[model samples]
Target: MDFLHSGLAAIQRHLAFVAVDPIDWKFYVQAFSWTVTLFESYLLLRQYPLYSKTSPPESLARHIGQEDFEKSQKYGKDKAQFALFSKLFSQCIDSAMLQYGFYAWCWKAAGSILGKFGYGGDYEILQSIVFSFTMYLLSSLPTLPLSVYSTFVLEERHGFNKVTPGLFISDLLKGWLIAFVLGAPFLAAFLYIFQWAGDRFVPWLMGFMISFQFIMVILYPTVIQPLFNKLTPLSDGELRSRVEGLAGKLHFPLKHLYEIDGSKRSSHSNAYFFGLPWSKHIVIFDTLMQQSKPEEVEAVLAHELGHWYYLHPTKMMAISQIHIFSILALFPAFLHAPPLLRSFDFPKAVAARPPTIVAFLLFQMILTPMEAFISIGMNAVSRHFEWEADRFACELQDRLKEESMTDMGDRLGRALITLHVKNLSTVWVDWLYSAYHHSHPTLTERLKALESFQAKRAKKE
Candidate 1:
């Protein structure tokens, strides 16, 4: 046993020496970053073949014709190819930035520039903010053309884009203005807290973030959304009456039903409710109203109500807080660790500590695997909530119908199918890919679950 233990220790020491002794830290950072990038890209591309191989289940086949099926497959292929190229380009840019010391150089340059203004010396936190802002501005400038091409060429090809160049430019300017208005105060507060609170900075930062998120949620429907799209109240009519009646029946308070001009930006459709309970408002996409029947629209709203019914949003918020606590607790240790800092070429001088924001960025790179795991876990929970919401919609539709147009399950199933077809969603996703990427089950899975529920209910009747 002693011999075996000695041999293992000797092997580990040799391996550590080989890993650390010969290569520059830059090479290790580049190698790890590229490896992760390539691996993720491969994971996404591999799913294309898996998706192509899987035949549609009988439940979905009934709703989608052979012609639509072929189109959907083609759609997936187009997206997969585009995604591969996008990932390659984005990762190459990121890798180049890391390899060429872009971030470190930015920190030095920003510090020097800020020093000219007499506000930079010894204020690592302010320097960090300046560095961060400069990096963000530089990185985003190159992507503007790519964004325009995707919106105009790629999305237009798919018949999804409704944005004109004028609207697009206006939207871009509005976005930047909003980002500055919202982000600057938060950045200042963040740096202030880090400087003022020494050991207690973690909890203070956590509290601030949670408060900011809650504020955003309350502001999203009323303040921010109006900047992007027009929101007009649903006119008094049968559809409005039905929606109001449905909301009343569910005991979910309705502040107002707003029809958003979603078609102004894209052909895709969506509906959502936002704000606190007292301020809850439903916003339905104009495209959805145009495409779906009044009853179908009501059905979609019912699903949204299901999320409220189960308190899924509150539950998710709680989960996020826990995650924040864990991250904040570990972050300081990562920031202070000599080896971690050394790996990133952080200054070795004892008096000159690395910027907190830079350390946080490094921490994120180290936590990539953990982040992926957390994403998978969160998506799994989200998928569960989605199923519950779907079932709630089905049951509510059944209860409300006096004379059934069709089985409530089948009605919702068809609605799902319609949305999927119209959106050109991938019909079948690989299991591993779905585990990481999907927050809701495929249309076929939900349909089957709903059908099974209806069958059991009928047997009881």
Candidate 2:
């Protein structure tokens, strides 16, 4: 009893020390980010048991074979187990850095090192650039092995990995090069704006950000994507003709259809409509075209076109801009908070004016909780749009191809099931997890929506 009492006392003293030692926003940053990590880990862990115990619903059972069903279960379990380990690893590294002021120490050390090389001024662009690069290098190195293992080992074991070591290394080098090329100038400009524009910097920075994102949207398919993968004009075929006809009927400004070499990376299939209004292009993954029938592929394209018709992407961009604006609006308070700086072990003088990069990093860590909630809402909106798009695909296919709603629904259903099998993805997930993370509805949910639409149309007929 005495030993037990003394042990309890020691534990209480340790808790008190942890709680009261860092009375600054850094403590909250550490706490909040860690809590969010643990919460996400809990979510994934909870879903596993629920998912493993649940049998395939009758509707799903009709499409997915029992053997495939079991495979998916194992797949989910394996992925979940790895994900838990990954999350824990990430949290340990991040929590250690935040708690031990390693990032803060790095920032100061990087600045001092840069100063010796004549790159140090009051927030010198060169210093900030070098500092940012060093931080990225350090953080990325730790995570790279996990990603490599996930790709080469776990995914390979599951038969999903197509990335060879040479390709993987090439991808990494190209990605880093692209980041340095694009990010350096943008970051330099951002720091310069903050340093020079004084109070008006917020709006200017926001405007610049909004513009940058828009430009990226326009350029990604044409300029950026071609850097990594080969893209060719979709071959002339019945599918291409049908796609063009459908585009014409919908009055979608489709310029060219391109097929991207997605199979080189993974067997997963996807299609998207991207680029500026005049330069709009539809990119179908080669894997998707190879796997899907013309009708199913057409249905997929119809769904993508529906997004434009409903202005879903535009609305999403608007939401994203609002999120950015809100965060930027709060930046002044976060930037000026001395306790936030001191909590990271910044000296009193440095705390008076926290560096922009430090401020951004701290803000991101502190905003984890808010971002999680916001993400849920965004995902909800996205799922709704996906349903709308699915409905549009059904309606358009019925109108153009002279197919019954049921026919179109079955095609969509078959395509989804095939995708699930090819990707080795689980058929269903926990409702809460799906709601928070999935922007697209489950196969069962989508089929139900399509069936409901069919029933309503039959009644009208």
Q: Using TM-score, give the best candidate's number.
A: 2
Candidate 2 residues 1-461, lDDT tens each? Answer: 45633553454444343323445777787778888888888789768885474467787877878878877788788888989999999888887877787777777778889778776557567766777888888878888989998999888887778899999999899889888988999999888888887544667888899888887886677677888899899999988987897789888999889999998888888888887776578889999888889878887887888899899999998898888877775565555566667878878777777777777778788889999899899999999999988888767645665553346666776787778877777776788878777888887888788888767777877
Q: List the residue pairs that clash in candidate 2.
A: none
Backbone clash pairs for candidate 1 read none
Cα lDDT tens digits for candidate 1, 78-177:
7777778877888788877776767777877888889899984577767776787788788787667778878998888888999999999999888877
Looking at candidate 1, the ten consecutive residues that score lowest on lDDT are 14-23
Please, what is the whole-model Cα lDDT of each candidate in the order they appear? 0.76, 0.79
TM-score, cand. 2 vs. native: 0.91
Off by over 4 Å in 2: 1-23, 51-55, 397-406
Q: How does each model score on TM-score?
A: 0.88, 0.91
Best prediction by lDDT: 2
lDDT, candidate 1, residue 428?
Answer: 77
After the best TM-score superposition of candidate 2, give how far the Cα of residue 110 lies from its true spot, in angstroms.
Answer: 2.4
What candidate 1 gets wrong by more than 4 Å, as runs, is 1-32, 50-56, 346-351, 397-407
